[model samples]
Target: MGVDQNSIWNLHNKLPSFPTLNKNEQTEVLIVGGGITGLLTAYELINIGLKVMVIDASTLCSGTTGRTTAKISAQHGILYDSIIQSSGVEQARQYYTAAMDGKDRILNILEELKMDIDIEQKDSVIYTEYDENIQAIEDEFRAYDTLNIPGKYTETTELPVETKAAVTMFHQAQFDPLLYIKQIIDVSIKQGLEVYEHTQAIDIEHGNEIKVTTDKGHEIHCTYVVQATHFPFFDPLGMFTTRLIPERSFIYAGKNENPHLKGMHLSNDTPARSIRTAKINNEHAILIGGEGYVVGKNKSSADPYKQLKQTAYTLFPDHTFISQWSAQDYNTMDSIPYIGRLKNKYENIFVATGFKKWGMTTSATAAVLIKDLIQKRQNPNENLFSPSRFELTSSVPTFVKQNSHVATQLIKGKVSDEGKSIDELKANDATTLFKKGKKLGVYKDEQEVVHVVDTTCTHLGCEVEWNTYDLTWDCPCHGSRYTYTGKVIEGPAKKHLKKEEL
Candidate 1:
């Protein structure tokens, strides 16, 4: 299944195209990703009188930032109690403060730039259906109160489904992320920051001056490099491979009752549902999201599209269905994003990733932290999310569990072949039929060109499913995506699948 168009936030709006890097370039700061983190970091640095350049494998916002739920909130699903219990009261408090202040900073930027990004302050809520989790919810609320965070506890919710209890945080927000990013990109360009699309940074050598080589043969020499690629492109120093795991989530959008719910909402339980609204061409649209799982795992026996449609109908029977889409996110084992310096082993290189589905707020927070570090300023939240911090207790177990799951999937997928022909495929259609003992992906585009790629996801060897809406091969387990020709369009899969000879 592919992403639904209606749920996409203001993507129809046009922005200037960024030229691809074709020659050698030098800058004071080189940002190796053009998503929210990279663009915002460049925007901030340019304002502070630093020469900045941003390079992307594809276009801006085409990565996880473009596919996010776009909720800007301090309330990250049932985390305060867990963090306070595990990391101590001060650490949890600092985390909450950083996230809350990040939301404020977004609003401030919107106002300062007078950008119309559909920014709205709606209370954020986290609810759960299981009554057994009510005590956990209450405990989280108590922790919030103890930290003096502006939040409240409630036993009832406005959701179509019933819930045991919910924790509401005031002054949280939702917005059209693309619009916000467009404004920032424009400002960055005006401030003399350079952005290059279709520029894939293939290698990075760290020193007093960082050297970045692009697939297109362009070279970048810079005093500093920031890897905002969601998962660090360079993993040797950060151990991002061991620290973070990728997950996939689905979203469905359609028209709903007049102002369905007043605020943005998410659940505190597994298979979580998130709700938010947007105005598309003067019409209101509702986005309901759930059905998440780790990469490569098939949670449903039925078709994902049918499942999403049925779920939406169950929640809003009278509303008209518009569009549906899915997004991939990286979840850190410790629930904190890895920000600041890359690691103790590498200097002059930095990274910001592992937002755990809260990238909208956390990405902004990362920009602030990275910008501070680049310009030699100070930020209190830097150490809390530092990449060097190691929790061996949790890290070891997480590493084992993740790798074991991957190995299991890889071994289980070595089955026999059953081929299907391109003549039988329909437009915007895909299938995982076998061809000559090799599992092959078959996708027919709107133009009727048949695309053939290996069905195996380059990340973790999970079988890739056809997402008809997005016209990409989607890894059901970890949310990695590839162009029909087997190009690595998304990651934690940094490498593309080897193209199978037809």
Candidate 2:
């Protein structure tokens, strides 16, 4: 399984199964995911003596949180300047302050709970080797100055790679997120915060008390429900799918012979690259991530993993990568995350999504804002990140363009045909093939077992494509994913694909 189990965080933090929702339950709040956001939300709510139940389709931290680079920082890649230009200076400052507050919240929790994890404080650097991008870097520095953010504009970095310009944000941090979260799980359980695995929240019936129905046919009636799943699967608002687009990126980890870098580095370039170091098996290994593209729109004829592997080789010569994995993220139309009440009419329902790739800080911030909303308190960042706050001028064109692209992909998927006959397919490979004039997703295991399912996505009609690296059927439309055997893994799609006989 070459780069299949790519994230080192997942390798170290395998969790045991918790109970599933077999009967109806009631709570003050029902959190619909067990990743960092859900767990953190539950922890916060439970601290205030509210009865909270957190459920996941899988185990805790098994989603995108387990697959993250684990960089906790305010330097979200030339973001402040863009926010200032679009939303304004006060909003940008609030964004910066919220990010720092997020980092501090994590530390405060760890200290209060006495949780031991491999967390380190380091600077975060946003750099670019391209000369053309220097003005953007300068503009970001100016934004930093206006916001009074603790950062310095630098000419060089501790990165082994050469650079044209860099912005260093001071005292940022990195850690093994799962390990820390595991401790949170233990404390949360002890504090009467209920957790259920293998329990997928299928749909929510909004009322005075929201009723969340799970895949297992159990109901969780709660005063409030938080959609912490990476993509807001049950978008009662009918606007989340349109407001955000899913992005996929790759990460390669290997031992480096050079001196370990002191800072987390991200490139401000077209095809972005991020560098950070981690301790693996008692030795330091470098993690190089970033080759982002719209999900299912990987137009490059070359495999993305191969390209990232080559990048790792160039950056760390003679270093053999132990693991490589890919993760998916969603970017909002206006760039800022939506992290509050789902809609005005439905006050009991809330959502936290569109964190771009900066989930560590954003998710933490979201937890506080969500808690405040439920507790009936004022949060300074509420207006900036309100789920209903739509920026018509900037976001409308982007919303139309993204949806148009989705429409184009939907048509392209239906019309395009590039598949092999069952007899021609090699072992341990997956492809979209026509079987008896029907488009089907085909996967052949190493033991020569064949699995076939309808290539059409269950969420929307956009045809699903075979992801060779992760061995799943991915949708270009809304980022829903399915296993080769037609089981729904991620959603936006509540139902599994229709299975087909080979």
Candidate 3:
């Protein structure tokens, strides 16, 4: 079943909003998003005595950062093995080191500020669901050894389900992402960083001085512009449409026997599950996450909540279900993020994106990398994630598949026939209806109230599928999900679908 407003993260709190840009503005540096990436960049720039301005399409931290699982770790599940094989031993080692260093930097900041945000040092484990991948897990262990990172290979895991093998990393961590972001924003503001929420950058005029034009007709003139808006809004460098594919991941929070796992954990196999624990006030909660796929690629099932519930029950039947939410992330083709300059063509314009599913650490790393680039300092990981590094042959298949799906949706026939009445919907079920040639998706909650919204997704105008597990309308093409009331629950859709009058 879909979660109501009782989410622990959403408890007793309203997000901070900043006024939209209304006129031409000037700053030394202009950042285009207010999430972790943008906020951190702004904060770092301000601390370095550079004037920085951050603009967001909505309230700060309301985007992907707010919905994140909030795990702060260098152990991006089963990635070290793949990185070592795909890139090289040195590149993999550097990546892991950079991530760990970033995690330490965040912890240092939290300690400096004396903020208590449920920060805990936990071990991170990567396990395989089936025995067929035992050798692969072993290979990953060997790769970790090459990096001198201590990881133990074991058959016993913390999950209630059985696993063949697992590799565990010690001293990893997780925290409440929203609290961390809010603290940073407050500090940045004190340091004279200008922030404008609900301000959307519509176009950019790149030259000696980059001019950012917002949807409200306001222009920001800056010597440097950072495209930290999850996906860069401009394609002058042709990055907005390529190099990365957006994907969706779901997470649910419930009370369980604490699993007492030493650290956060994830599974390497399909239907991946990420496990962690959090505290709401004084009570502990378990967060189980998995069931992710490339957007629009799968619609075989209307809901996966039952599967999550079953997993929780099987793992720790003694716990209770509390809060649940899902998040969407962008994945790059080569399994690495694209940071540094926008491209060779645009020297002053910078971009930070394509963190795959490890944004919490990668985004911080991006801030460090971009800050170094802006200050003309040497950063070790710059070439590793440079935007110009093109391995086209490896990415072409995914690019073709994703764009082909988008093209098909653009020209596909619309459902012009009227569909079922609102009264026909049952609690916790949703149906797509066409009324007078306008397509609508209606969902009835546990309270038997119907919330209607346009079935069309704001991103690329694709038809959205009903996600019963989260009780939201999901777009298959770009992984955009929205609440039944038409509020965008996830992105790369910044705008909400138009709500239908009930």
lDDT of candidates 1 onward, in order = 0.78, 0.85, 0.78
What is candidate 3's lDDT per residue for 1-502, written digit by digit as tens? 4634334565524566688788899999999988889988887788899999999887787667777787888887777877777777998899998898788878877877777676888888989879888888898899889898977889978777788999988788888777677788788888898989878887888777888898788789999999898877766756656566777777777865445667788888878888788865667787787888787666557355566667777776788878666667888777788898976657788888887788888888899899999999999989988887875645667678777877775555254323556767778878877776778888887788878888888876888877666677877666767878888765566678998854
- Model 1 worst lDDT run, 10 consecutive residues: 1-10
lDDT of 1: 0.78
Candidate 1 error regions (>4 Å)? 1-7, 414-479
Worst 10 residues of 3 by lDDT: 410-419
Q: What's the best-to-worst order under TM-score? A: 2, 1, 3
Cα RMSD, each candidate: 3.1, 1.9, 3.3
Candidate 3 matches the true fold with a TM-score of 0.88
What are the runs in model 2 whose C-alpha is more than 4 Å off? 1-6, 256-258, 434-437
| lDDT (C-alpha) at residue 442 in model 1 | 70
TM-score per model over all chains: 0.89, 0.95, 0.88
- Tens digits of per-residue lDDT for model 2 on 1-502? 4224748887766665699889999998999998889989999999999999999998888788988898999898898998888878988888898999999999999899987666789999999999999999999999999998888998788766778999988999998888888888889899998889999998888776788999988899888889999888777658787778989888888876654678899999978898888875467777889888889778766677787788788777878777888888899998889999876668778889999899999888999999999989999989989888878866888899899989998889887766577788898787776767778888898899998899889887899988877788889889988878888877588899999987
Which model is ahead, 2 or 3, in terms of TM-score? 2
